[model samples]
Target: MKEFDFIRTLKKLSPLPWERTVGNDSAFFKLKHKRGLISKDILLEDQHFFSSIPADALAYKSLAVNISDIVSDGGTPRAFLIGLGASSNHFSILSALFESLYKYARQWNIPIIGGDTVYSDKLLLSITCLGDAPQNPWFRKNARLGDYLYITGTLGSSAWGLSKIPTLGHELSDPHIKRHLYPPLYLDFPSLFKNKIHAAIDISDGFYQDLTHLLEESNLSAVITPETLPLDPSLPPEAKNTALRGGEDYELLFASPLAPSSRRWPPNLQKIPIAPIGKIIN
Candidate 1:
């Protein structure tokens, strides 16, 4: 069965209070004084990534994807737990991975709280991120009809980078390759657009597919203008399809009531070029 089909089956079995969190990027629940948000992501060698990938790159991407989920929901990540399944107990690889992971952890000011490790036939990484939820956290179901759809940064760079990896050998010097390996994290986005964003999802599974998730959850549709897509100018004309369907971009695709030209955004955020690509429709 397909991934969504399996998810649908799981959702049916989910408990009443948790059902709403099943399909969202992060699970939100009440805390003593403030709400809490949590998300988990798993990466497997030869599946989510290649075994040839460097330990540092693999570690960074694993943490980044999970953090993206928390940020998309308008949460500030507080701490994370990691579960590692190693095929072999190689100290060098493990050390490098943790070194990179901790470096990013310090940079984000989030701590590595705890987790477990196990022996396996292949390398596997599972990250569970916990964060402080915003007053009105963004959700896929919160998108309203007529809300404008906007996307951050560019698309297709990660996919383009992946394609070149076989030839370029994971060189971080190439922008595309670097994007595929170390996706740019938008940690400050939620704080910047806190009040304006209605719904949001990180573009890890391609723009079209992830947008479909947002629309489905909102019980709405959308009308997208192809020309409005913020495709990277460096990409070739033929890369449009890749930009639409290529996964692992890790950029934010969100809905907002404010028009693309709305001056309601903060001055600093105004400088970031968020493209209005589509609008939620009936």
Candidate 2:
């Protein structure tokens, strides 16, 4: 079975209460005085990334992706726990990873609360992120028939960067290479839009696949205008296909009745382009 099919089977076996929240970007629950959101992600060497990737970049991407999950769910990240598995000989790498991890944690003001570490033959990293959720968190199921589909930032840069890794290891000065190493975080997006968004998902598994998740959950279809797709301008014309199907952009894909206009966005958010590429349909 495919990854999503396996996930569907697991969701079927899950308890009734959790089934409702099981498939979202983040799991939501009530906290003492506020709603809480949580998500976890794992990365393995040679699979998700190459061994030659800089420790700092690896650490940042690992933690940032989990934080993306929280933000996609309309939450502000608060803290995280990390699990690391590496052979003892890689202590230097571990040290650099932790240093960079803590640096970003301080930069983002999110704390590293707790987690476990184990020795393994291969390098592995896992992070569980916690956040304060909005009263009504965004979900894949909340899309409406007339909502416009919008995406933040450009697409395909990361994929393009990945293709260059074999030829240019650790040469992150290249913008595309840097994008692959460190994805831009949309930490303030949730708070900025708040209740304006109807549905949301982060583009981790390519535009087509991730958008399909929202459509399936919302029981709707979309009509995309080919011209409106926000392909990375830096990529060549042939890379248009990569923008549509390549994964790991980590940008926000959301639905709303109102089309997003740069004129209305704050200066900071304006720097991150938003484009309406499609709309929901029956």
Candidate 3:
């Protein structure tokens, strides 16, 4: 398909009320608040993914990382714009990508407004996501001493899955491999306590390294009980260390005051399994 055809296809898929398709040079969005959050993440062919990965999975990830940022800030994702660069003549790949992106957009209730596409040597995707920043969104600098550091879901699974991707083809459907290819849309957890969390970040760059970012942003330190890490039980022993250093888990690492014993978080999140693994200090 040509560039215009691709744009038309996207317009057909986007049914959100705020999406305005014509008479304007840019897509229109409705922002309920004065403050907004905008974030971008780029995926390069060789550096970010191998050539063998499915186009659909790559498309899903292109938007997922950006969604991770919006919710991490305790904001609700409203819309996005995608920039695509590709040299391949296979228009079917482009179709698959658009379909995959639309699928995720509907699941998250976010819309793809507008973007530019170009021909390049390899597949390249740049996504810019916009959202309404909460009145009291979580910030890295808000971490305070004595607040418990908690993480939702397991770590190291993405790293483990990435390691196996080379040997296994796109058709391979292992759970760990699926985790790496399709990170969960965990925005629900952040939305539950929107203005209440102390500090928050998605564990995209491994748990420990991202924790360092939180500490640096807050100018505070933390003491983690290594034994308390919520590691993936399925990871092999040799890959255990990846739990701390492997990136791309995309789980939320957040800080909150200790809750009362009677307090129960949204039980719907039970499937993701939240855990308190450490405390901010110094």
Candidate 4:
């Protein structure tokens, strides 16, 4: 018997939510919330992202991608509702996926309010993240030309880790693999929440592409420095280009006046490596 996939079957259901490729908000009602509107994207087989990845990994990836939008917009993810399609065949994997969602949701202090489940041929996860800010959310347009440029963690580490699984030398733990498996959300949104961060985003897509959203929205330009960027130490010289351009690190990229380098933060943000990747020029 051929393997059943939830996503494959979910797509075949009658009255698909999306409308003809023009202007469509037919499924908008499903996104309603109290403090903020909800956002969701359904992934069918071979769609959204690479299809060959594991189900649990896919579940986390689905959440990461959706939350990235909320993080970039400076909203605290209050909760999420995951719509799942998993048949008996994939139930184990699907269970692991939802379990991971609960893990992350709890870690982030967000709730898994509710969702729908259905039988499907292949796995499909339609995740919706809900969040809001006091004022209008942080956006690509708020970047100031002279504001400081900053980012969290090294660039391309996730992509690099996946491509080159480092030799597990005397190491007992697998944080690196876990990182690839479950991309971490910094949650230290001081920049956005404090209004101290000027231009900000999470590196969900490749760093090279996503930053453009900020520049274009701000009607400004940028100049990234080769040295200041935090790249993976394991990356050879040949792979630097791909690492820099290949996003998905999901680290935060925001502009703020130098954070307190004098003292340490409980879980601090470093000042180094986060150099002037580029300037928002007038």
Candidate 5:
């Protein structure tokens, strides 16, 4: 079957509100009353790149940023589109970047159907990934006051690692360095929903910003215990505050009630284990 045929068969109605697709062949589907419009835009600059980052990994990171948003809402990535800005001197570097994109694209079984390019003095790139939700996309606003909160991985290390340096120009290749480079993507979210989580959202900006989104979405307030939040092992004792507020961890922060047997929640779902850091209240 054609790719479109495969997509058409995947959509299903969920209890949450969602926009209807005109057809699977269309370019993008919009939010009728939903926020999960596909093709999320993410921008990057020289500061965002490192000389040691492989093009494949850069492409993966670039693409993962957008895909993270879609999948957090239970959307399936269908393809990608890019907006490129670079100079004649950097064409080869940029070329390798996109080559890296295709690596994950193939791993993800997605397509790069369209994009635009322009000349600039330096590098600036944006990736817009198209994804579809089988059910209504998850929203941060729906977090209820009594719901239990969870995160897919530890926080703080990505920025924490970026803040520190090594001697003799040797880059650290430890877990913290890997966390800084490639964050854990919650690809197994379908299994997470089996436990009846109340509402969900992914952490993007910083914990404060993300938690604000959850409260905004649910129309509730939360009191999170700092000590209970998952912290990176590599974080300096002082960096604990940064982990609380530093962003770009890209892990899923979701809410669920304590299950009859919380034991059933997957072992890989969290790095530090899902602790009830706070309670949603009016």
Candidate 6:
């Protein structure tokens, strides 16, 4: 199928609010009251993933990474624009990709509005996700001196999975490698935590590095007890070191005054494991 044909299928599957005029010069989106947020992420062949990875997984990751950004700011994704670069014979792969993309869009209630496509040497995808914030969005700069530093889900699991990707040959069934290919999404965090969180960020660039970003933005320092840090039980000692430096986990790291010990999370989030790794220090 061609680009236009695939786009038409997307409109049929999950049409955007303004998709009636999508085929024109540009797409249009409008919202009242709530603030709009947008984030873009570029995934490339070899640089981001091996060619052995399946197209559907690639498509999901492309959209999920962008959604991670929206979630970090306490927002709900509304729509997305996809810029695809691939060769002629990639139509079948593109079909599988669109199927996965549209499926996730419907599940998230977001639409694939519009984008540009071109022929490239290798498969390249750039996704721009747009979202709406119900209230004031969280930012790293808002962290308070006494705020607790927390992480949702496990860290370094993705790195551990990445290490095995070369040996396992892009196998998604393996639990370890699967984490690298499909990082967990924290969409419910914004809704569950609500306005309690003062600052937030997605751990796309590993724990320590992204933590540094948070601290830098807040003009504060933090003390993270290595022993308290959450590591995958399956990871070896060597993997622990890589987990701190490795990237692409997509887990959320937020600063909040809410005491994790005193509060009981909703039953649905108990399985995800939210833990305090450290506390901000002036």
The most accurate candidate by TM-score is 3
Whole-model alpha-carbon lDDT for candidate 2: 0.81
State every prediction's TM-score relative to the real structure.
0.85, 0.85, 0.90, 0.73, 0.77, 0.90
Give the per-residue lDDT digits (tens) of candidate 4, residues 1-282.
Answer: 334454444333412222221244222322223446346768765454443556566767788777776776666666677677666666456545656677667767766665666667666778888776535556768887766566767776566556544354212144544566567665556442456666577886777777787788889877777677877676667667788787568777775544435232223444333444655667
- Strongest candidate by lDDT: 2
Please give the range of 10 consecutive residues that has the lowest summed lDDT in model 6.
13-22
lDDT values of the candidates?
A: 0.80, 0.81, 0.80, 0.62, 0.64, 0.80
Q: Model 5, 164-263: lDDT tens per residue?
A: 5332111546656666667666555744564356667667687788888888878888777877888876677888867878877887787776642567
Tens-place lDDT digits, model 2, residues 111-153: 6665655666678988998898888788999999999899999
Q: Give me the displacement of residue 179 in model 1, in angstroms.
A: 0.9
Residue pair clashes in candidate 3: none
Model 4 ranges off by over 4 Å:
1-37, 44-56, 164-177, 190-193, 257-276
Residue-wise lDDT of candidate 1 within 1-282, one digit each (tens)?
Answer: 532243234324422322233355444443434688989988887888877788889988989988999999988888777777774434447656766777778888777665656666677888998888988889999999899999998899999999888888979999889989998788888788888899999998999899999999999999999898998888877766677799999889999999878788656865456888989999
**Per-residue CA lDDT of candidate 6, range 81-200, in tens?**
888777655656766777787778778777877787666767888899988876778887889998898888888888888888888777878887888888887777778888788899
RMSD of each: 9.8, 10.0, 2.6, 7.5, 9.1, 2.9
Q: Native-vs-model 1 lDDT?
A: 0.80
Please give the lDDT score for candidate 4. 0.62
